[model samples]
Every structure is written in structure tokens, then in C-alpha cells.
Target: MRFAKQKRHRKTIKRFCACFGFREPFKVLCDGTFVHHLVANHLADTTVSNTLGAPVQLFTTRCVIEELKSLGSSHAKSFRASCRDYKLARCDHEEKESALNCIIKIIGDNNPDHFFVATQDIDLREKCRKIPGVPVLYGLRNALFLEKLSKFQDEYLKAAEDERSRMTDSEFKLLHKRLKNTHGLKDLSTAKNGSDDEDLLLQSPVNRPLRKMDTKDTVQFKRKKAKGPNPLSCKKKKSTSNSGPNVRKTDETGNDAKRSRSRKRKRTHTAKTSNDGATN
Candidate 1:
């Protein structure tokens, strides 16, 4: 059961990373409420990293730290001791404001810095949900979990996907070129010499009249030409005698000499031996 829950949390983190370009060592902005929860529950700061299954950098704004200081000595000491290593985020307020307001103002509508908000405040979490590209994290008892994508975030993802599926920049440029050629419109960059071309360039592209495109303007494929036989696959032709009848006769004679008509008998010295035996 725990494994399944961990898998689901990791999947949610992956979605945020894919959509909002979250990088390694994720930045988690900790609020005063979240710090208080950690201190009260005796939870180690590593719980955030363990929950997300990634390296994480904890950050707290000056306002949040100021709010933590007002919670009394015991809470302040323990919280500061535990999170002493956390990086302080600059909130840029001359006087300290409420932690909620400070965080909301920094995040704005889009969460451009790609921060994962770690907070126990219900209001803060709800506000984060409405903004696109902000992943929220909260704790239940000892277990920490990343929140699922809200409706706004999901819609933003869908819109981005749709935009990607449309034509690319190169394709749009090619289309513009084809349209200009089909309408016989001179390119605006080269229209400096002609008064009419300059006037036409002043008008919007949509205001131009649509006419039937010429056949020449359409793309034409090259016709395939006849090809010669493959030299490697062809048999070599016989060479003919070019000199005259003498060269032909010589060639014929050479052919006749090369041809074997019949088998020849081996010469024997048996007659000489028989005469010598008779004489002996």
C-alpha cells in the first residue's frame, strides 16, 4: 500500500516537472505554518526530499521567518535550529507583511519561478491551485504528499499540447512563400523599385483579393527518364575482327587450332624392339 502511494506521488511530481520545467534539487518554498508543523511533529527536513524522491532545496521568505519569531521562544528556537541551513528568499518588502500575502504576491498568477509550495495553510494551498505551474505539498500525520494538478494547471497543459501539435515555424514560412507566389505578389523586402508593389505592401495580407492559382504555381514532380541497363548484370558482347578478310581468316585459323577434333594415339617403339629380338 505504501509503495502504491509513493508511486502516485512520484507521478504527480513528474507531471509538474514536465509542464513547468522543474530541474534537479527542486526548490520548495516553506511557509510559517509548514515550519511550525515540522517543528511540532518532530519531522526531519529530509522528509520533503524523501517524499518527492528527489534532491530538494528548502527556501523561506523573510516574512515567514519573521512570523515564526513571533510564535514564542520554544517554537522559534527549535524551528530556527532545524532550518538554519535553509536559503532565505528575498521578498523585497520594506516592512514585514503577512506570510500569506507575501507569498501570494511573489507567486503572482503564473508562478514563473517554478516553486513547489510546502504549506499547511488551506487558504494558501487553495490560492496556489488557481495559479498555473505551482505544485503544492502538504503533510498528513507523518506522511508527506505532493498535491495533484488543479483544473487550471490541467487546462494550461492541454492548451500547450494543442499549440505544439500545430504547424512549426518552418512550415509556416513555406506556406507564406507559396501563398505569395500563388497570388503573384512581389516580396515586400524587394519591392523598393516599384511604386505599385510598395503600395500593395502597405495593405494587409487579408485585404488582398483571392484569385485562382496558376498551374505553374503548383508544385510539379520531375518526370523519370529512361535508364541504361546495369553493367554488372549484363553479359559482355563478342568482339568482331575489324582489319578485313585476312584478320577474320587468321582468327578462324586460331579458333580451329584451339578446337580438339579427336583423341591422338601415343607413338610406340614396339617395332624396333621386335626387330632387335629377332636379330638376337
Candidate 2:
């Protein structure tokens, strides 16, 4: 295959694998038309696996083999022989049904089995596009192509991804569990007449357990109270000595000595007497 075509096919396979949970050893379900195309084109059936670039297990339902058998063409023998090597997927049809109907029933609304549909039937291809997680493969001449996701498939993938993004795995599990319990409660309410189990589940707070608050959990603010005056702003008191009496006495004696020194002597009389004695 050309590099561009291979790359495109690879990308389409990857998108299907990522979005639809396709795993290794892909299971491809083939119908009679596709098998006939392979035989008519003289292509090796392994060409499909090779183009896919992955280990593949081809599958066909009993109805497809029956349909090919009914054709009665010599090419139809080759188609049946081509399908002979494929693994049979049980349609379990007690009566014969069309190959398209068999494939559709197997795929259902969503392909939980992760089937890659190989077909040349336009109707089947159109139907596969509408169902999410079904990747269709078709061949032109010698080249095989994996079809890109249809609009419906893309929209389904986007919606599923959006839902998954909005909810985590744990949330999904919890939601499932809650639903189970709700259903159980509803059943119990119906069995016991006049029981309010469902009503309580919907409206009462008792449905959910209350968390107990610890004493330490209570928020306590530090209250503002009256405090002593600021020590920095107060006047300093004089530090008194232990000998208070002796200090007072010493202060009084110092005051007396100062008064005696400050008193005036009889200097005037003494100076006049000395002058008269010298003159006589």
C-alpha cells in the first residue's frame, strides 16, 4: 500500500482503538460479499491483516456461509472456501436469515465485542456507521481501506468522552452504587405498604450520615481584654537606698554646714581695731 494510504488507515484504526477500547489481535467480522471480493481480486486473505498492520483474527457467522452456499455460483464455492479458514461467530439462527441481519443482530446498538466490519455491501456499511464502535473496511481494486468514523460515530464518541471527562471512575462507581441502593429502597417501599423509605431517601437528611465535629475543631478567637499600661511610656520611680534614715540625717547635716559657711563674720570691727592700734 502507498505510505499516505497506510498512514490514513493507521490513523483511523488508532481512533477506533482509542475511543472504542479495541485491543490487540483485532477481530474482524466478514460477510459473504467481502469474501467474494477477496477471492475475485485474487488477493490473499492475509492482505487484510497486513494492511491493518496488526495481528488479526478473521471471523464470519454461519449465516454468511449459508448465504454464500445459496448463491450456487462457481465463484460462490471459492467464497465459501475462503470463509472456511475463518472462525465462526455463532448467530444461533434456527432458521436461515440474511447475512446483513445476522451482522446487525451481532453488533446490536453498541458493539461490546469490538468488531471491525469487513464488507462490500453498501447497506451494511451504512448501518455499521450508525452504530458506535463499529469500524468498517472496504476494498477498491487491489487496495484495502479502513473507513473513517461516520458523523454519528463521531458524535457518539464526543458525547461519551464528555461524560467521562465530567465524571471520574470513582464517581461512576459511586453513582452506580447509589442507583442500586435507590432501586432497592424503592422495591422495599413497594413491598411494605405505606412505608416512606423512598420518600426519606429523596427528602430526608437522614439518608446521609452526619460528620461529628471534634472539640478541637471549634474555632476560638483570642479575645481583646484590658492590659497593664505600657512600661515604656511611664515615668521611672527613684530607687531608694536601704538606709533611708541615714540618708535623711546626712542631708540635714550638709544643710547646717552650708549655713555656717555662708554666715558673715565680724570682719568690719576686726579691721578697724587693727588700723587704730597701728596709728597709735
Candidate 3:
């Protein structure tokens, strides 16, 4: 804890020369331990004090909520009540990350909202300090002390002035000369001595786009055309229902079907009579 405090002080001095904490509302992240500490001291009213450059807003992660629930019934209830004042941020790695690890990951990520870890844990504080631009906040005697950090990309900054001064007078030539034989320049005449307007019209029947021929589709269509009619398909079966004086007109096929069913019965075996009797 002492080491974390000393290191925080040193970094805060460096921050004076570095990042300006112009964050409209500096977001302070609280862990389970921080939440418990805040609740125990009845410090919810003072959690968002104006000691920092901008107004402060308290926030906690889902992992912190899980951690609070694991603490027990009473503490969980208190944490739940305290949470109404702070926004709960959904944690991406709930199963894999601890509260401290999750917090470190959230703040250490590139171009994240400026956050200050409001906790009393020495290990967590020390861990957060290693990341580029994170601040540590601790409560002392009902007041909060914020340890600010400012880290910049020294090498990534472009040396524009030096580049401007390095350009010599001898290298004044422009790149990429215009070519006379290029497509747009060479084609000045729109008149051509070839096909007529009708041939060029894509909408004409002769110029219609050809369909992509597929053997499978053509073969399937031919097979479907050649297939026998389904016997189960409903045929307009005409029954000989007498409709009061006017019989419904029947087609030739129906007549033919009736004729086939009423074919003359074959003679019941010609009497092998007289010959049979003599033979017997």
C-alpha cells in the first residue's frame, strides 16, 4: 500500500507535464472492495467529489457485481443498493477475468474513456499503474486523493518541420507526366464506320443476351415433358346423373370407357356336346 502511494505520487508529478485530464466527467471505476469500503464509510454522497479536473462519475463492472454477490447476503444487499448510484458496465470476460484483471484490461485498451481505479487494494493499484494512462484513487479520512498519470507516444509524433526543411531546390520536378497516347486522349473522334444503330442497340432481338445453357436443367425439363400423366390427378369424371330432363353432356372418352366395360361376353365354351357324348 505504501509503495503504491509513493509510486502514484511520482507518476502524478510526471502527469503535470503530460496529459491534460479534460475528460468532461472523469469516470471512476470501483471494484467489490472499493464498493464495500465506500458503503462501509457511508461515502456514496462524496464518491463523486470535485477534486479532479472534471466532475466524477462512479462505475462498476459485472465482474465486480459477481464479486460482491460472492461476499455474502448482507454485503451483497448493501452493494446492490449502492449500485443504483453507479453505472454497471458489462464485462466482456466475465468467466475468465477477475475484477482487477478485468479492470486493468478495460482501462489499458487503446483509446478508452479516461478512468481512475478507485480501490484500496495494493496489488490492483500497482497493476493499474503499469498501464500507460491510468490514475489511482484512494480514500483517506473521508476525502479522496487522485493519482493521475500521463504517458505519450514520443516516437510516433511526426517531425513535420524537419521534413519541410530537408526538401532541396534540385528536386523540384513533379511526378506522373500526362501521356498523349493514353485512352481518353487518343480517342477524340466519336464517329465510327462500322455497325448501324440497330446492331448496337442491346435491346434488339438479335442483340439479346444469351442464357447460360445447362445440360441438367434441359434434361430435367425434357424428362418432365415425356413423363406419363399421373393416374391420381383429378379427371373431370362425368357420372350419368339425371339432371331433370337435360342430361349433362358427356365427352367421347367417357363413351369409349363405357363401351369398353360393356364389351359382349364371350361364348361360354362351345358345347363340346355331341362329339364329347360319343367319345364318352
- lDDT values for all models: 0.78, 0.78, 0.59
Better of 1 and 3 by lDDT: 1
lDDT computed for candidate 1: 0.78
TM-scores for candidates 1 onward, in order: 0.62, 0.59, 0.46
| Candidate 3 stretches greater than 4 Å from native | 1-22, 94-96, 109-111, 148-280
* Worst lDDT 10-window in candidate 2: 203-212
lDDT of 1 by residue, 1-280 (tens): 8899899998998888887888888899988888777777878988989988989999888888777788788677545753586788778778879989999888888887778899999999999999988899998887787889999889989977765655555645565676567656666555444456445444454443344456898889999999999987797777974654333233554554233345799887754564565752
- Model 3 — which ten-residue stretch has the worst lDDT? 171-180
What are the clash counts of all predictions, listed in order? 0, 0, 0
lDDT of 2 by residue, 1-280 (tens): 4999899989998998887889989999999888888888888878988989998988999888878887887666556565677898877668889999999999889988898999999999999999999999998998788998899989988877555445444544565467557566444445443244344334323233233446698787989999999988797887976563333333554553222233466655543564565752
Q: Rank the candidates by TM-score, best first.
A: 1, 2, 3
Ranking 1 against 3 by TM-score, winner: 1
